[model samples]
Target: MNSLTRWVRGPWTNPTASGLLIALAAIFSFTEGVNPFSDGHAEGAGALPAALIASDLLMVAAAVVAGTPILIKAVRALMTKMIAIDLLVSVAAIGAVVIGQYWEAAAVTFLFAIGHALEARTMKKTRSALAELVAVAPDVAVVMRDGKQVEIPAAGVEPDETVLVKNGAKVPVDGVVIGGTGALDESSITGESIPVEKGEGDEVFAGTISGGGFLQVRATGTGADTTLARIIHRVEEAQDAKAATQTFMEKFSAWYTPGIIVLALVAGLVTGDAVLALTLLVIGCPGALVVSIPVAIVAGIGRGAKDGILIKGGEYLETSARISAVALDKTGTLTEGKPYLTDVTVLDPALDRSDVLGWAARAEAGSEHPLARPIIDAAEAEGLPVHGLPERTEPVVGMGVIATLDGQRVSVGNLPLLTVEGIADDSGAATEVDRLAGLGRTPMVVTLDSRVIGVVAVADRIRSDAQEMIARLHDAGVQKVVMLTGDTQRVADAVAAQVGLDEVRAQLLPEDKLTMVAQLKADGYTVAMVGDGVNDAPALATADIGVAMGAAGTGVAIETADIALMQDDLLKLPQAVDLARRTVNVMRQNIAIALITVVLLLAGVFAGGVTMAIGMLVHEASVLLVIVNAMRLMRRNEDQHSAGPAPASDARELQTAGAGPLS
Candidate 1:
């Protein structure tokens, strides 16, 4: 069952079917044209009519072969009462054909085919963001076996196996470089344009292109476990999970068709004219109403792609407009997620920053924590030498560490760890700690012989565009903005204020976030939850619309979310929302136009002011006009990213008021 499902869902699902339909259309249209066009009366009225008929017929056959199975399935499900509205339109078109209106039937079929083709093309273009990632994945990898290079499949390379990556190839998996130095284009993973340089021990993710020189990296993951595969899967699922909006035409199509048929019958009985009834049947098709929403959706999706945003589908684009509040994650969603060293304090005046970091790095050399890597990395970058730890060392869970360095007892950890160990019970250390924490920094205390020493502050930087993006959301009619984070309350509050958010829910566990989302939903708010990856999965799943930062977001988060922003740009959130709202507006506009056109045509037909040929011409022209208007959505994307200006400063108001520092 799984195998069959995979096969049907694969790329081959509609290609063969579309090819056959196109072939049939070409054959039929050619047959219709052979007799008249060959007679050499090119300027004759018959010639133009015959040529148009031939062109339309050929297009119909092409579209059917390309999309017939899917359309057939849609129609069958509707007829079987699975989807009643679509079934009505399908039946009406068939009725037109059965009553000797072959031209009308052919026109309807051809238009439907073209719309479906446009939809398919949009999906393909949107998915190319992920497909490009897959295309760059390494096929054959160089693995180190017994200190010699051996060719092996990327899938076969196991964890900790050193693989050589040369110039112009993608990194096979997430891993650290062990040899050589080079620049790497990690834009596929981080959405940053600049290619970053990497040396030994620097981490790289799969799908990043290698630059300028060879490097040997130890593979940390592979296959579905690779970062690229996870990202691709997340994109695919997010696009698929977003349910489409039911257009005005689609919702009323079933009953509307029958109502029109009845109206036509009543008119014929009252006026004794059969031609008027047929004219009513031709004018009442609702082709414009049907085409409105999907066109806007396609345009929105296409626009997103151009601006480095890849919206999965039409549903997500529509849902974004309805969002009243947004839930944001901390680590990767707002901050850089990459920790950097900011300041290092020394307990002893004699011991400078360099001396303290060197001692701390040596003690944490064997630690596997993410925090530890940056400390050791900082020490190395500063050219400070590290020595092996002394006689005793111990780790205090959720706190700092205690060890002997240079025959003296040295302690490193959070403030709680220091207090518990009976160290640095002083006012100066307390003041410094509070100062660092207030800036949304992570402070690490270093003590010597139970005496107050200095502190090291590390922090993840906020994205440069975050402040402006939040402002745009408000301008676009978002009622409220909320931030959810697992960080300390102080840090959470600071980030919230900086981003112009209305509320901040700090120190939330994964389950706590889910509970909060439920509370918001119960209050009837249309909430959009945006997150990076794994930690945000629960909340993402619970929100009205789950929007994942696809490239950096985890597989679970993306799969759970309703929308995936491929570029991982926070600014794209506002752009998507505006795009959706505009698309909906366009759909409404098209519907109004189509309905007015139908009503006017029906009145003229019943009054005998319009003949059958004139009615058909006017009706067809209206459909074409509705279509052209909807296509405007495809072009309106240029305005989605019109960010006014960079924010002056989030801290400007506070600075001017001389406000006391926040705790």
Candidate 2:
């Protein structure tokens, strides 16, 4: 069909045509002194009565223009052996015209047509978020094909191909940066507005816009294999999947529509009252009941997607509403995953602070342990000389490293390594190690030439918003926030105290973490486990909800995690929970409104004061009301309240309040 023809035949099309025809008909009826309710004659032999004839003709034309599509839909539905609301509406309008109620016929068809158009427009607004996402999907990509840059459809880009993305261009595939650097705005994928810096080996996702830099990315995924595609697919499935209440309503509606038609037939035949039976058919369309849950689900899921929270489905939303306890993996979740040098204590007065730090950095120069970077960074920051790797280095599996530097023995590790090297703790180095460990710092004793020199400590700094995030989780109805880590008891206690945790599980291996999560579930707690490492995978899977933090760049996390918080912000956890609770509340309210409207309409129809036009109006209004209620979820808060950085004094107070007997 041509565009105009298709539009004219559409359910929501050409409302202005129906509206203009109705207006003309009303004006002509008034001019001829025609009372539609009084069976006024349009065939009287006079010029004045001719105006009445024009009014009746106009009304019939308006009814036909607006009601033809509805009749066609009714016929198609009948061919399939099913009845629909359009069928009910068509029957009522046609029956009214057969009885010479031209005004009623025109009014009912016009109102139904216009209401449908408004409903379609409003529903599009409710789904605006997903539409916005689809709009940003990249259409083309620039790839280095045969060493020459060529543009191709984004879906046509082959895996492992090097794609070039310039400033302000949307990335066309999921890939890792192999050359150059750039900042990418990943808000479409992660809901974070900030542009994340990308460097060599950093991951980038499709549909993310590059910010002010050139990048050569090796495409790992394109088209349907990309993370953005998966997210969109998941959201669509979530919105389409019927909730339990919706399924029940659907089952009720399946019988309700046909039952209403049967009742209409019986009522008309038994009472010989055609108008009353037509009124019954119009009122019994089940409009609100059929639409109540879907609108809410679409709006709720769309809102979450806009905020960078991905709910698996409506069923998950229901489950999320009851979450009481949250278990968090310490590393990369509550703390910055990167460790930094915090304390450098001198044990030997002969050796200066720089000497101890330089010796430790030199010993760790060739090491690949995570803690080594901070020591080297600190040394470099202070302009200390750390030129070359050690001539010979021996690493103890769980202890530390022993290296021979410049013909002298230099060791950097825990006390166990020092003991293995026969270094005595006579200088009270053991006490200092204990003190640092008690303060949640990982202490490494430095020894030179078989003599204890000093101690260097590194600790993962707690995120500035960690305390406030826990506080907000409690406010959001979370009963307890537990800290789980492989760190020692003292370190775990220190962090737990700082973050206001209700419980702490320390020195837990990967399997131990899993056990703790299972234990929480066994204790009847709806647990949400938040983590960001491979070791956490087991615990994350074991929890009721697996939330992956800083998941924007990780395709696996985005696809697999039950709830993936795109940013590393601690506050998103509570925010996700709060959103789930709000969505569930909206769903319940919509269902209640829908059921009540159905009950009241049915009662009004049986009580004998309702007419066909009024019944259709009430039914349409109820559907609109349910839809408007669902659209409320799409409304963003004017002032988004986010957890800001806490002051230094607040941190001190938290540390004091959380301190244990050791303090």
Candidate No. with top TM-score: 2
Alpha-carbon local distance difference test for all models: 0.65, 0.81
Candidate 2 per-residue C-alpha lDDT over 32-98 given as tens digits, one digit per residue, 9 for 90 to 100: 6776433456445555566677878888898998888778878998898877778888988889889
lDDT of 1 by residue, 532-637 (tens): 6577778887888888774443444434456667565777788778877887787678778878987887788766677443554565566566666655655645
Task: Estimate TM-scores for all models.
Answer: 0.70, 0.86
The TM-score between candidate 2 and the true structure equals: 0.86
All models, RMSD in angstroms: 8.6, 4.4
Q: Number of clashes in every candidate structure?
A: 10, 0
Model 2 CA deviation exceeding 4 Å by range? 1-10, 14-21, 24-28, 37-109, 143-149, 156-164, 175-184, 196-203, 210-220, 258-272, 366-368, 647-663
- In model 2, state the lDDT of residue 184: 92
Model 1 CA lDDT for position 374: 70
Q: Which segments of model 1 are wrong by more than 4 Å?
A: 1-244, 305-313, 359-370, 423-427, 550-558, 640-663
Query: What 10-residue stretch in candidate 1 is worst by lDDT?
Result: 652-661
